[model samples]
Target: MTGIASHPEIAATLALKRRGITLTLLTTAYFFSYMDRQILAILQELIRKDLLLSDTQLGLLAGFAFAIFYATLGIPVARLADRGNRVNIIAIALALWSLMTAVCGLAQNFAQLLAARIGVGVGEAGSSPPSHSIIADLYPPEKRAGAMGIYSLGVVLGTAFGTMIGGTVAHLYGWRVAMFTVGLPGIALAILVKLFVVEPPRGMSDAQIVAEGQDKGVIPPLGDGFRTMLASGPAFNLVMGVTITSLIGYGHAAFGPSFLQRSVGLSMIDVARYVAPVGAVCGTISAVGGGWLANKVAARYGLHAQAWLVLALKCIGLPLSFLFYASSNPYVAVPLYWVSLLFVSSYLGPSFALIQGLAPLRMRALWAAVTLLVINLVGLGLGPTAIGVISDLLRPAFGEDSLRYAMLTFAAATPWALWHYWRAGVLLKRAGA
Candidate 1:
């Protein structure tokens, strides 16, 4: 109050710095989260060789065993975040998963590895929901996509580096050492977050905060949150669209290294050196540019236009993904693969922003958790596992090419996702959202 009479600009500048710093730390935590999760993709082959594990077992380790717990635990943890200190929750989660990821190296058997991965998932369960809630509070509905998009850079960058670093390390030092390499740094990040990130009042971005209290109304029951999230047609369709996309996305992520190695004859180090850079650059563009572009489109055309962007991206990307997997030439395949990633990943910012915009103030974290629940359970839980099993089934006939064809089969069903986005667009437009 005293400052407002004299130097308001200083307060504003300090506020901006705080917001930027918090977002950076949260995004960094997210980077480690996805890195810990996706690192398994590049290491699967080594683990399979050392453990004498089948692709199906590897897929379960990579997907279902982790996803089932992560998705299931996220809801309750999110409910906690909606009321508790979200900064603390996120910090604790980062520490737990980072430690679990390191423990992954110590596993002597399949069951031991599964348990470690399950712990990783459990820790990761507390990650995104609270982060999403915090982001929603920090940025208003209009700018949220761009903010979320910046945050989502963690996903692309993390996935890319997971392969680049993991692949290189696996080639040189082996998979266990790679796990330890990626996992330990997150503990320090957790400390930074715990010390620095501040929890904003709930509904602050929605202009619902008041001095007497946050004044956002009572925190609703779990059932109420479920209803609030489900009542929106856009929410339903958007969640399903993301879920379907994830089914294909996670499937490809789990096996893509294998396909590149066996079908295209790329060495592990080659993928790290040559292939990962393509994804890193293109995916960075998509994550940052997609949100900026969507914000511009939404400003001019309204929120409905965001859905249209997603629709176009998917429709264009699916064909390119087909070409990426089918091609034999590294120059051709790598370029196509990165472009497909750019297109498919561009939807994340717009979709997540829409979902968050639609949520009730008190239930945002729960809503995000529910969205993750279905997406992770059905998509992450099944995608890689199904692809792995399918690859095995086709192994007798196709040998090394089974993983490629298995991924393609998953890709064929992507049109279902496009339809959902189209329907969501129609609904948003009709509602004038």
Candidate 2:
């Protein structure tokens, strides 16, 4: 057993089934994390009325309260993951966040909710970096995107369920009940993860290691993750591209329910029934299909082709987003929303798989952590807040129409993100892919 464990190539066939189980459990964990985080979005209108909080306050709860701790704490947590037992870290983190999510339902005021959200962030911070590392070790570069696409479905499915269930529960009972509804099940899921998933040897999936220029057994210093990421021009651009992309994506996603309710006169029930289901279905197709499509493109053209694929997805989504927000008609906006989600959600698999491939094998978790720190701190942390502030500024002029234009304000920045994707592709092509 020890001999086989030491030899990854020899063990690959035997480990294949375990790999599937691990990925499934990890993806399910991600789903719950996102669902817990996103539940507040569906319940925000009710929360606002109950707590007498402003949009800015809600944004703080949604963005700052969560993203700050989630991003900052991730660095140390990821460092631990790189050297420690990733399964234990994931299970412990999942349990912590799940408990905090339930606690969020018990909060009596903005301050209490703020603390609970922070706890949720702290727990979630430990999840992704390690999970990224694990996935990278389980699948090679060619298949990584499709695997990542499957993993990224957590975001799509989580967001869908978050809105659907949160809205339904909040509509029938109250917001507090909705929080508990999504929060408790994660604890049991955490246990399942700890029991079912086994830690694979680092560098198990990679067939070579010229990029690291070091022994695979040597644990590189923490700074190596940052240096390694920046060392590659394409990788740097990919990271920046995702950061920009997520900024706009999180903004629209967080505010979407509010926009429909406030502007289109859709109720919570309407959002759950009419909007959430569309996003789930379209985003699922995009997430899985994007990875599969990028893989086909990469196999035919080169891995660099993925950049172009993601760029196209972003371009398609940008116009759809503008039309979605601009239209006052529910019928028009809802369909546009579905189409926009299809294109926009597809970028995740292609881009994330690229970043994981770019990182050094031993330092993948930290590399992912550093990338996430930037994305969450600047993108997720500010996206919702920016939208809220802009909406507030536009409220006097646009009145109830402020959120629609506020979302559009961020959607215009999609072009800047697309430029990064184009640059990343150009750099990768120059390197001969």
Candidate 3:
């Protein structure tokens, strides 16, 4: 009631309007980010055939090499976001990553391509922290989960569009052309974001942001803010839980095209045409719907909506993810993949919303950065590479079926992820709501 304006419904509607715009911009930025990152996956076989690289080498290129720069740089940039202008940071990052993505098309050697991917990663590291901070300022605590979920649709939609387009273009023209095509559009979007999106005053949504700061002239240093987050039991559990879940999600996302190519016997174009679009549509719906459901469930129960939402979604996802991983038929596999995407992807919104809700106004970016550091390092960095390593190791025993087993093993981790979510929920309860 305090934060709401004179006309109660009008205030709520205005809040939704602002949050929607923020989420839209964030999602669009993410769409380009993923497309640029994944153009190589659609082109994997061609890159391998043309570059004459092994699976292990490809894994490194896909996983650690990119993750190294992406994860490491997130903290420092996040620190800057806490202290400086986030929109400006995102705009520059967009241009840098986009230009590098286009440069990927020009690579003739493995090293050049690797360098280009590294550049893309470096640029991308700048995106999340600032975006997270912006979203926290834009939405109230109760709405954060749904808002974050909507924002995260960017991941699903981005992957869908990237794979769809990457596969088609690579099929028709070549992989190089596909990379250039996706990369160029982002530069323009970057300019638009810079020119149009205004950074709202921090702590506009929640009463807590101002309580965390602005009362005292003292600005909490980035390290102190990070330490505060790490000190919380709920925060620790939540970050770990999400990281584990991400391991399965990112790993699958990375190798899916290759799996289709090798096992399902779909060409890159076919993967693009069929799998990508389906994934995008399914994933977006699941993500958005999950948030809506979480908010509804939490609001009704008067509980920590985020914790309950994640627990429910992940519980549902564990079994579905296994079905998705094990299915051999493309018809069965594709639809099941959506269910899996829904379950895993749904958590992003709630988790992010919770983290932002708990964080100090000045530390929003830092909190996002810290969480990303753990998530990307453990999830993105290890997830794909671990699967690749396992697949290669098991190749002699499983033959072409090695990937199937590897995916199943990864899927097995989901139950454990759910356990962590439950633990986080308990901690949130102990933390006094």
lDDT of 3: 0.80
- List the candidate 1 regions with Cα displacement exceeding 4 Å: 1-16, 208-215
Candidate 1 local lDDT, 339-407, one digit each (tens): 888788888888889999988788889999999999999898999999999999999999978888898
The runs of at least 3 residues in candidate 3 whose Cα sits more than 4 Å from the true structure, single-residue gaps closed, are 1-19, 208-217
lDDT of 2 by residue, 316-424 (tens): 7888889988998998988988988888998888888999888877788998899899999988899998898899889999998999899989998999999999999
Cα-based lDDT for every prediction? 0.88, 0.89, 0.80
Rank order by lDDT, top first?
2, 1, 3
Q: Candidate 2: where is the Cα deviation over 4 Å?
A: 1-14, 210-214
* TM match of model 1 to true structure: 0.95
Give residue 246's error in model 3 in angstroms.
Answer: 0.8
Task: Summarize candidate 3's per-residue lDDT along 1-433 as a digit string, tens digits.
Answer: 2334445455445545666665677779987898788777778889989999766667777787888899889989998887776778999999999999999999998899889989999999999999998888777877777878888887888878888888888888988899999999999999888765656655667666465666342458767876898898888888888889888888887888888777666678888887788678778888898778778876776446467678887787777777877777878877787667766678888788877877767788888989998888888888888888998899999888788888888887877778778888888777766
| Model 2 TM-score, 2 decimals | 0.96
Angstrom error at residue 167, model 1: 1.2
